[model samples]
Target: MKVALLYNQKPDLPENTPKYQSDEFAEWDNPETIDAVANALRERCDVVKIDCNPAYLQQIITTLLEEKPDICFNITEGIGEPSREAQIPALLDMMRLRYTASDPATLCLALDKARTKEILSYYQIPTPHFRVIHSLSEGMVFLNEHHQFPLIVKPLHEGSSKGIFERSVVYSVEELSRQLREVIEQYKQPALVEQFLSGREFTVALIGNGETLEVLPIIELLFDHLPKDSRKIYSYEAKWLWDDPENPVEVFKCPAPISKELADEIASLCKRAFRALRCRDWARIDVRLNEHGKPFIIEINPLPGILPNPDEHSCFPLAARTAGIDFNALINRVLDEALKRYNLAI
Candidate 1:
């Protein structure tokens, strides 16, 4: 078998530059994780890195067709446009190339928080009520209605907790509007203001094909050190503020403590959502409990992080380990599922 990594290799529009001519941010799906997966594939297959940029989709498509790899370990996150993450997958779909994770349509839908929630709601999966605000004026009015106090605001198209911070949590209408304007001005896009459900948060990792999908262990964010006044959200600061020397999101804990029944309920709902979205190879579903302990999905992460650490905040990998699958074994399992889907010899 032969494999290639499709990834975004550009930065976002720089703050100072005009939207049309800003320097791009560099994103390569992270080389270490790709190398780990590649090494795992090396045991029985050949792997290559195709550093793809969303702006160069035509080039990526031409290159991939030329290489004709047996499979692609798609870790691409498109840069610039809202549909950036979907670019590589869309090309693969057009070329009839086999890749991993959710399909192009699903990727596009998933990246749009509002649309994803709409699908989940239609399927009867529990998620927070949210309104997509395209402008600060609309936000100001919507804030007065349709939302309770203590809401959360975020840039609709960004993932990995981008544009999310402690101030993203609002306890009053005024604060919500202020945050809304700030987000719109900074992100230059609509903001998703969601009803905040304050409680324990967990991530469920899913792997495998249609009928044999396996839900790995539930991972929890232990908020033992979080202050009573602060909201328990995995915001940008909590996720990436490594240099502040005083960051406060407590360490994440895997094999989250919960009753067997609650765990089963989460796993069941998550599996349903994954199947509904037609996710393949692997994905992560993030769910937070309401005050009453009911699971309300925060969101689905089709492209999950598999950083080389079992303990410090890599939930999916931690869950995989809990299932008695090592990193290499986990990667092979995902590959096995993809190969089976493609009906090729493993």
Candidate 2:
């Protein structure tokens, strides 16, 4: 089997890079992660690495055409456009190639958090009420209509906690306005203002499709273990800065010490969200409970991160590990699922 590992490698920025731009590549996979995925695929197939950097789009396409691998293991969190993550998949589709994860349409839909919420709403799935604010004036109008305090603001088209900070949770109109401006102006995207849920947060990872879709162990984010002054939500700092391999923050609890009934409910809710989004192969769905203890879909990540390091606290791999699937096994399993979907022998 020949497998093309499609990925965007994080660029090494200069030390003088601006603070705001430091996390510009947060969504892109590190070389360590890229190599890990390639190595895993190499175990069972002939692996070819293809960097999906937009700067070299022509070169990338030429390489793909030349290699013509049987399948592509896409993890390219593309650049620029709002539908960036779908770029590689769209290209693969144009090439009539089979790949892992969701289709281009689903990837594009999931990237826009507001659109995902609307689709979830249409399906009668529980998600927080949110409004997409394109400008400060529009945000003010939303704030006037919805007087919900303690709302969370985020970039409508970001993942991996990009542009999310502790200050994202606004308790006052002033805070909300500031965040809305930052997300709109700095991130160059619409701001998603959502009613903040104050309860336990959990992330669920799922694999396969339809009735065969298997939910891995649920992971509960222990915000209580965060710094004293930090907010309960999983901010970018909490994910990358505060937590590291040397001194890991005791944050996630796999298999989530919850009642079987509650676990079943969360699992079922996640499955519904996955199917609604038309996710394929594998995905990670974030869920947070309301003050009343009701779980609501936070967001759906069809292309979930798979940081090989156990200390990194990546939710998807952590959940898979708890379910007895190691890093390499998990990678191959996803490929196998994709193959099965394409009716190709593994």
Candidate 3:
């Protein structure tokens, strides 16, 4: 089988870029990650890499038409509006081409955390009670609400922990207002302020489609190694800047040591959220417990990160390893699942 690997390489920003601007556009696939996926696919199929930067998007379609690959192993993470993640899939669909990962609709809906929560709430899926604040006036509504504090705020349309930092958790109306202003002015997007989940946090990685969907080992995020003043949430610094591959932060514990009952409950909630969001091929659902130990969906990544290096702190790959699937095998498994979904013999 011929596989056209579609992806977005992280941009090489100029040295003088303002730190804030750099952080806003920092979510892109690392070169090593793209190479890892291609190498894995090369073991079982002819691989042709196509960078899906909008500047040369036409080249992707041209390569697909000329090379006539059987399918596209897409991992494109475009920039711009919240719908950016779905743009490449939408293009492929227009050309009647098959690709991996969720469809454009699911990608768009899931990318917008506010919309995803609304859908989850409608389906009776437990999620943090939240509100989207477009301005400081909108944030005033939170002051009167009886919801408990240590509220967490994040950009409505970002991933990879962008716009999230230790200061994202607010304990008072003043703190909430300051954070809201930062999100609106810096990210230019509404801020999603939710009642913080104070209990343990775990991320569940799933592969395959429908009844065959396989939930990999659950991975817990530990903040014990973090600085004393740092909040428990996974901040951007912890994900990208501070942690090192050679000496990774002791943050992840896979196959989380939990009771069978608790594990089953967490898994069930993930599967429900995955199906409710209409996710296909593969996805990573983040679940966190509240004070009572009940699980709630924090977010779902239809296009989960697959950082090749284990020490980079990529949760999906870590969970796959716990399930006895190595990096190469994990990549191929995803492709095989997509092939099966499209009714193509592997």
Candidate 4:
């Protein structure tokens, strides 16, 4: 089979680059992920890379049509634009092409944090009680009706711990108001003020079709490694703080020591969430343990990261490894699952 792997790698950069520009994050675009997928598919199929750009999207489609690949293994993480993240998959669907990962509907729904939470809540999946506040006045409703203090606040449509900080977890009405104003004015996105869960945070990796979706080893984020003054939360800096010696980026422990009952609860709820979102292929489910020791579904990530290095602090890869599958084997499993869904003989 010939396969084209699509990624949302950034399209271009400024020419005549200066010395400071070389280290920019955009410089580390999509090749690494593309290369990882390419390496795995090289042995089983003819693989090609298609980096996406709306300006030259026609060229990508044209080339793929020419190649006539049997399928597409999408790994695109289009930088800068969130909406474009679903563009490649939607295009693949329009062409009636089989592709790996969740469908466009799931991708778009997961991209909007507020919508994801709403779906989870509708299904009676436990999560932090949250309200979407378009302005400071709306935040006052959370204060008056919910009567919840020490809530967490952040942009309603972003992930990867961006725009989250100690202040994001507020303890007082004054603090909530200030954070609400900052999120509204600066991010220009609606604010999500949620009741804080003081217990542990976990990410559960799930694979297979909805009928038999499998939950791999659950991973825990160790809060003890965080700085004394920092809140026991994962922030953008904690995710990308290179210079901080005490960063807990390396503190992930797989198959976290939660009781078997809680583990089963989390896994069952995760599968339900995957079904609720119409998640296809595979996904990762985030959860939190409330003070009562019950696990709550925080959110679902349809396009979970799968870097090759399990030790590099990637939850999906680590879970795959714990499930007794190597990185290449895991990638192949994803391909096989997608093919099966398309009724294509492997």
The superposed Cα distance between candidate 2 and the true structure at residue 16, in angstroms, equals 8.8
List the candidates' TM-scores in order.
0.89, 0.95, 0.95, 0.90
| Candidate 3 lDDT score relative to the true structure | 0.88
Per-residue lDDT value at 78 in model 2: 93
Q: Arrange candidates by lDDT, highest first: which order?
A: 2, 3, 1, 4
Off by over 4 Å in 3: 14-21, 141-147
lDDT of 4: 0.78
Residue 329 displacement in candidate 3 (angstroms): 1.2
Q: What is every candidate's alpha-carbon RMSD to the true fold?
A: 4.0, 1.7, 1.9, 3.4
* Per-residue lDDT of candidate 3, residues 1-346 (tens digit): 8999999887888887744466545667768988999999999899999999888967777887899889999898887888888999998898888899999999999889999999999999999999898876766775566756889989999887888988899998788888999998988889999999899999999998899888899988898877788788888877765565667668889889999999999888899999999998899999999999999999999999888887777888899988889999998998988889888976
Total clashing pairs for each candidate? 6, 0, 0, 4
C-alpha lDDT values of all predictions: 0.78, 0.91, 0.88, 0.78
Model 1 segments more than 4 A misplaced: 9-27, 54-59, 242-250
Local error of candidate 4 at residue 246 (angstroms): 10
**Candidate 2 accuracy as TM-score:** 0.95
Q: What is the lDDT of residue 296 in candidate 1?
A: 88
Ordered from best to worst TM-score, the candidate numbers read: 2, 3, 4, 1
For candidate 1, give the lDDT.
0.78
Model 2's number of clashes is 0
Which 10 consecutive residues of model 4 have the lowest summed lDDT?
Answer: 19-28
